[model samples]
Target chain A: MGKDGEVDFSIIGLENEIEQIQSNIDDLENGKGGSIAIIAEQFAGKTTLINKVCSMNKNRVEMISLSSVVKDEKKLQEIEEQKQIKIIDNCHFLYRHKIGGFDIIERFLKTVTSPENKQYITTWNIHSWNFLENTHEISKYFPVQIKLQGLTQEQARQLILSEYEEGEIQFIEDPTENKEKMINFVIDNTIFLNKEIGIPHLKINYRQIKSKLSRKKIILTPEENIFENIYSISKGNPGISKAIWEQSLVYPQIKPGDIKEPCQDMELDNDESFILSILVSMQNASRSDIIEIAGDEIDIERALQVLSKKNIISSEREHYTIKPEILKCATNFLRRSRLV
Target chain B: MTMVGEESGSLSGMPSIDTGTLLSVISLLIIAYVVTRVISFLLTAFSEKVGKYRIKIKMLLPILKFSIYGYTVYYIMAKLLEVSAQELILFGGLLGAAIGFGLKDLFADLIGGIIIVFEKPYQIGDKIRVGDQYGEVNDIGIRATTITTPDDNYVSIPNYVIFTQSVSSANIGNSEMMVVTDIFLEHGSDMKIARKLLKEAVVTSRFVYMSEKHPITILTKDFPFYIRLRAKAYTRDLRYEFNFESDVSSRAWKELKKKGIKPPGANLIDSSSMPDQRDR
Candidate 1:
């Protein structure tokens, strides 16, 4: 699709969404300036799509990432003064985790929607957008709303595989016979022992079992179509599919089955779960931001440790984010617990 | 007459009863009671496990209990006593007369329960205030509705009371509930700052439900001594109504105090200057 290890942005799906945005931009160029909201779930390619749209009309559009300018009213005003089509990313940050959190969003909306010769395109997290719509009637202000759908199987495969070179890695598929052998070995090895000498003994060496399992590697070729498995597992989310693909790779070879299905049964206490729910709701947050949202009573560091041990989230520098594949699971967990 | 005697006397077109049939009827009643209790316990446990969808799980309890009890009554009459539909109708008339004379209240309660299950004025887990008792409905029984009050007291109000008293349900069936909190301040307090601070408290509260349909509103009323500020908002869940109110009120008070707003002062009476009896 492009040079090796580079994602061919053009071939990625969402042509319809891009076309609609382009038409809106065209309308803006003809003096019909209005607001449009690009709404999607976390890592559903909202940023990538906006980047592509802006790149296509680099000279005509001004890109403003909201997360960078959310607290800077002067920067916002400066961007507002420029008489050109503007694209804003992460507009949901305007809704903070505190009281009067919607004030910034309200002010931004007022400034953008004032009868003027300007058009603005904004992106938002689906949860935040829903909350704003429910509380502030945000949809009325954004007359044009574009929701990005999950990638199709073909799209997911193309997007994910585009990041890897041809013949660079080998795929591994577990054969039915080998799977049975592993299952039998695990079951036979799991034995409950009773001590007669008045001494407690740990019979199961978990590390040994883990090492044995890790050592048993089987490799296959690319013809196995394991991309379909990744796509299905990620529910055709391009970001998630790509993350799973990357995580599954072990240098020159990869095992599709080795990738854990993102924290489905991890037992989290109430505090840990609450912190996780906040993280999922906010998509990404800093430690201080989480502490503020969770309140002083909660031992946030402990909760973070628990979540990290459970592999529910990952931290990069100052920001912590849930893996794309786990985002849907975490959201469902929050919904089931009625935290949302 | 005894049930067994009545079965034997059916040939002579007269009712009679015997010890064996009486024992059978008693055993059947006990079995029905025990079975219903067991089913109820299992359902309750299941509903607790499925917390968020507990309401949907609870909807099955009334239906199941009705079916089980109805079948048990039928089984006792038709299978145990070996009575025909015609005999049931005749017996039902006599029983109706007895109920009309002595069990009117109990019968009304049962009928009221059936209506409640069908009409759904309120359901299990709904936050309802019946007369002076306000609480979440814990159980809906054939004779009474049990409510677990905020203070954790289980009150069993008769089902028939629904016919006479008004029941206020905070949440009809949805999880989200509107919570109203009131804050009082000195009459001369700044309205702008008070309103802004109270609104911020609500939107920032962990329990508050922020949605367009349930936008937080702070309305003020001028009283002689103080200004009554009522914050109308929604909580994410009905269970957090009190917590949400407490959070908003405490936060608002803190902010108001930080902004130099004070509550109404006590009224002072000048007793020293009052006319003495000797002077009069």
Candidate 2:
């Protein structure tokens, strides 16, 4: 997958979303320009989809990624002057982590609305989108909202299989028994009627011991399809599924058990877990950024080292991110613990 | 009530409590108390280790302690006393009568605790106000609920208070809580500018919960001497409620000052009014 260099920009499960965006662009071309928001979870192909739309209308649309723009009114004004359908990616970056950070979004909204001929196609993280939609009624500014759902089983299978030659990667069923057995007991009572007293007699009787066993089995497809296992683990998120597939590769054969979900069996200290959660929420963070968010009380360097050693987080050019295969797990851990 | 002798052939209905059994029961009670204390301490430590899940982990304490006590009493009654189910039921009824009459308040508190656990009026780590005592609930025991005030004062209110007075919970069971911060500006101040600044202050606060569901709201109330700008926003966590309030207030005041909006003069109102001005 890495050697492919460039990914084919065709969206798999988001064909309907792409069509809606194209229709909106068509409206912009007709001088009936309006705003549309493409919302999805982090790394759910929001940027990819936006790029695809931008490429489809290459000559007519002005594609601007928010990450590339300085968060200033002048930059927004410059973009506003461009007399074309605008595609804005990573609009959530306009939201500041500190107080009064919403000014950029406010200014951007004003600029977008002031121009009757201007139409904006924006992308946002679902969390940030929800926050904006709640605080400022951001959806009201965008007439059209298209949410990108995760890839389907078939779509994930096709995407993952595309990386390998036909029959090159064998899907082997996991031979290990993963089911857990638990014994439980239930108590019951019986009642008898006494004809002489014309009343019902309640007797507490002890029943013979009976074993009630419960077994949990891991279901696998009868046909050798490794993508189903990957989809289940990653919840059909293309990025996460791809990461799991890459991690599970054993050359010619891939076993379902080979893909070890990151941090599943690892124990993390409170500080390490909290730092991990921050990474998951922010996607990628530097040591200083994590220390800033965690305050001086936390030993962020130590926590980073510990997490890195556990392979839950990987350091790249001084920035730390949760391993992609376990992105869902990390997020789930934070949510289950109510840390984010 | 007839007393049944410990001897198998005794005709007395009252169960006999021998000295050995008494000593064993006492030992068991002491053991149960120690175990409960140890478990509570361990669970509390574990809760801290879990970070944001502390409240959920601590919630298990009451259930664990209850089970332990229940089992200990059952052992004393059934195993130690060799009491039948029918006799145990009768003894329970008699004990209930005694408790209802002689220890009514204690029993009421116990029932209140059970209700609090099941009905969940407030939970551990919830920022709640009962009567005038407002703080984060630290522990919900059978007798009383313990709350740690902002000043770190530990106040224990009897659980029965739940039945007599209204209990106000800021966040219910959620970690995020709405914090309403009020900023007063001199009369005739630019209401629009002040409102915008206050809203920005809340949204920008480090402690604020910047989510659509917890949107910041700015409202204006006019009085003779001042215009009250109220900013209602939520803190990301209940623990940050006061921090959120202070952060928004300080930021809003700074921005208001920068915008040349002044607060009402202290001399315009009575000194007594000035003393209670920051009550909210």
Candidate 3:
């Protein structure tokens, strides 16, 4: 919201999604469509759509954003019943990845199914949603599951431009234009102590990955090309696209090639991969919470250091989180190892 | 041979190889060697990268190697050396005689290799037991199949052993493998809680892989002195089979002990008081 209490943000491609959610919310009075589970990849803007829906239906919707790992259902139950439709953001925190981790989420899910006059709209991390889908059948609790799709190029452009004033930023084109190669040999410093896994080997970036990942050597580019590259890399992920724009922009001037793909090494060991998956599922975790869940078998310190050094994760004091820019890549890479 | 074509250094009517022809044969041998080595390296590297399809990709190596070697042999006889009908008959006679005599086992191994290639009872990356040697199939070579046992010992069993022995494959060609973990509890321990904890431990394991089609199963059986709580769960990858078992067992036991579930004393694990069953 603005200083005068006007709407500060606009829903771009999310209009239809927001409408579907609102329609589901409207159907709650007649007891139809059940609650909604807004599932999406990291930085795909699940919270934004929830907020937009809440803003539209202010009187009827109540919102609670879980800021950290939720180990108990008391916090959820303590919230006073006010609105017909309750929105819980970051509900992924309801479950930990331990033997008894599903208890809290299980009880919450039961409550979602129990007799009630209201519907609940919850947002969850897609990874956590997948794990729970296998373990707890979490989707059963929320009949209306909206797996949010990424934004289109035009939508991404508008959403990003909405943050800046007209003529405030420069999109400069370079006079020098060089052709790009379909294949490039990039060096990724692999951190393996064995020294025989061939860490320093040349990594061949094929045409597809090359097109998605910008060149290591950034050349000056035009405005539209820059956004195209950003969209290609972010895959229309609004948060990532916006982050790329912000990183690329230098004060008032920006170039097409300024958005550098953070080529992070994801060749992690079993412990490291497990820790990374925990972080991905939980979104963020306190250091002690991570250690406790990881168990004594895993060297949490070594794994965290490796992840931090690889730029795959960031640590602040007692908390660790996956770096947003590399989230998609890390997720895809870990999926190969069945880590996420 | 000396009585037939001794002066010309020929086997009856068969011509002796010239320097150029020998050089071409040597070059072909080099090419075949290099091709197989390069293909093996590429396949192994590609398998590791395409993690989900590692076994599927590895299953191609033996067939590819066989085809390449078969083609090389065919080309050498038909095009390079250009053997005649009579020469082929003579060669066949010599090979038959050799096989009938000292080379019978080698010939049988060759045929066994062929059978293994065409009819794959097991392939590379599969955990299988041939005779008494059981482990993951590390490499399927022409003469032998190599397996790395659970104890980390590399055991090589001849290809012919597959024919003589009963072979069992744990996971045919799938990445997910079932690992059965057993924990022996005292007769009076809480079975319900133990089973629940075991199931939870297996499902929540970092290495666990569960789906609707491939679900985790827990079973209980009564022993004379102890109750065995068994968990049958699938590890995400077969490579982590042992790790999965150890992880689940440790987690389950930790929870079980905390809940005051006791393990069978003296008679089960103790060497001196171990239970014996000789009843038919």
Candidate 4:
């Protein structure tokens, strides 16, 4: 986690996105442009970037981080009067997902587009940004839109290891000669004398094949393979990669095979899917907010229970959020369903 | 022309077929069938896995099936039976005449299926209407195109209908399809709020898919009895067309009623015809 005073490069591998944002800020400081919207997936470091921007600009910008839905539309109007630039995080909370949920967002859009001397910087979930882009052409209002990309293997390594001292952690290798074999001995049941028998079935591991093929380009040392596997599973997402790394770590030693893939499922009803989409857009939605948005047609408990059973989301103190490791899979599933 | 100088083993200008050749033909046909079934299963599984490329991947099914069967037939005639070019043409002509006389409808349907595959009128997963049947096209078979009606009824319309009747596809080959939702309000209702609520209802619907290319549009027109508010938006998937419309309409109506935007009273407009042109 980055501090408010000094921002770290926790959002590694997003130099391009940071550069684009910095260029936009430069243009704003010169009085040459409009507002900017930082669009990214949850836990992709939107908040860290905002802090970095605030600390870099010192007194020129004021930050407003919305922890929950904004019921008062007028509260947004009363920004720091001395600051010319305002950075609002979780801008997706500006509106709800119900019938009359768009009033506050509409007012905000109008205020931003009405030729005020001030410029605003906002951070939004990619899915929420997409919904607004389609409905209100939100992109037109924010002249600069920067989407944060995922971290690379090197960047993920740096981000994950930034906290630990050199040689404090041990990178252990696999005991077997064949670490990432493309072929594996998978178990299967075969009928023997009218009874089922378990036997070792020779199965081809396609993922191992891909990993092996990818090794030809960048071969890592004994310890680097752990980060590579974590990167492969997490897809270089900083939060997910770090989470997987910590879970796989045993005190000072960590093994490559310790990093396993997340569990999979094939069920999501319409209501469950809608709830997941809402949670993704909001990043942190209370149970009541979910029920209110889903309305009467949905059995909110069943949906929430199903999501919990699948380990796709976790709730604490009535607020639900997607698991960091499951974020990519959940997003992909939602995208396939067109819910996000 | 003359049985290839009598060395190709022809009987009455027809290719000679022995027991071995017949077995080979059967084996070839079995292999082709297995190949097509496996390919179909894999492609369908993959298409389900990736929704964005569902149509593009499924569109390859008919073509792949045809290629496999076409090659199987060609191999059986040209290599297994060792039929000459001239003899093959003569046999094809005879078969064509027999089909023309006895199975005209079947042949027409076959040709229509071929046209559907190549001409790109509509493919699998498209929302189409043929004659009076409207639904999401589930499968495009050799003889007919099967669609699951909004009522969830699987209706198989003959492919030949593409030639005889006017066929319309709401979404040509894309997953996002435009759905028209209408909301009627009293003459003295809050028009601006109704429009705003309708737009919000559409944009906020979980089933809706919006982008710069597929925009949500709301239009209003004053009718004799009341003003009709129509919302034109694209559903994420054509299969969710009705659900999207219902989602938008119900939510918009709920908000409209709360805001005192009363629906036009019963019997104010003609029950039989409410100017469907009020759509669009």
Q: Runs in model 2 with CA error above 4 Å?
A: A1-10, A27-33, A74-84, A170-229, A248-257, A264-323, A333-340, B1-15, B27-121, B160-167, B184-193, B210-213, B222-227, B250-271, B274-280
Give per-residue CA lDDT, model 3, range A1-340, as digits (tens).
Answer: 4459764455667777887887888898677779889998878888888888888888888888897878766788666687677889999889778877767887788878888656899999999998888777887888889998988887887788887899888887744443333455564544377563433454454433665575654543476777876887788889888888888889788876576656544577888889998998888899988987988899999999988878788878789888777887888877888777
lDDT score of residue B240 within candidate 2:
77
DockQ of each: 0.30, 0.21, 0.64, 0.66
lDDT of 3 by residue, B1-280 (tens): 1122223766665457766777777888889879988999999998987777899999999999888888988888778777768778988999999989888888777788888878989889998977677799988887888899999999988888877888889899888888888888999998988887898898878999877777778888887788878888789899998899999999988999999998988646664544332111
What candidate 3 gets wrong by more than 4 Å, as runs, is A1-9, A174-180, A185-187, A190-203, A207-221, B1-14, B268-280
Backbone clashes in each candidate structure, one number apiece? 13, 11, 0, 0
CA deviation > 4 Å runs, candidate 4:
A1-32, A56-58, A74-80, A114-117, A177-207, A215-219, A263-267, B1-38, B79-93, B276-279
What are the models' TM-scores?
A: 0.80, 0.73, 0.90, 0.86
lDDT tens per residue, model 4, A1-340 = 2457554656567667667777888888788888999998888888888877777777788888898888797667667778888889889999898888888998888878876567899999998898887777799999888888888888888888888989999988877873657776767655599898988778676667887667477766767888878887788778888888888899799887777667453457778988999998899999888988999889999899978977899999999999988888788888888888
lDDT of 1: 0.75
Better of 1 and 4 by lDDT: 4
**Cα lDDT tens digits for candidate 2, B1-280:** 2123445535555457666778888999999989999999999887765545677777777778778887998887767777877876887899889997898889889889888888889888888999989999988887999999999999999999999999988877777788888877789798888887788777645466655466677778777777778887777678877777887787678668877899888777555554343344
Q: What share of the true interface contacts does each candidate keep?
A: 0.52, 0.38, 0.69, 0.86
Clashing pairs in 4: none
lDDT of 1 at B117: 87
Each candidate's lDDT (Cα)? 0.75, 0.72, 0.81, 0.83
Error of 3 at A32 (Å): 3.0
Of 1 and 3, which scores higher on DockQ? Answer: 3
lDDT of 1 at B58: 76
Candidate 1 Cα deviation (angstroms), residue B153: 0.9
Model 2's CAPRI class is incorrect
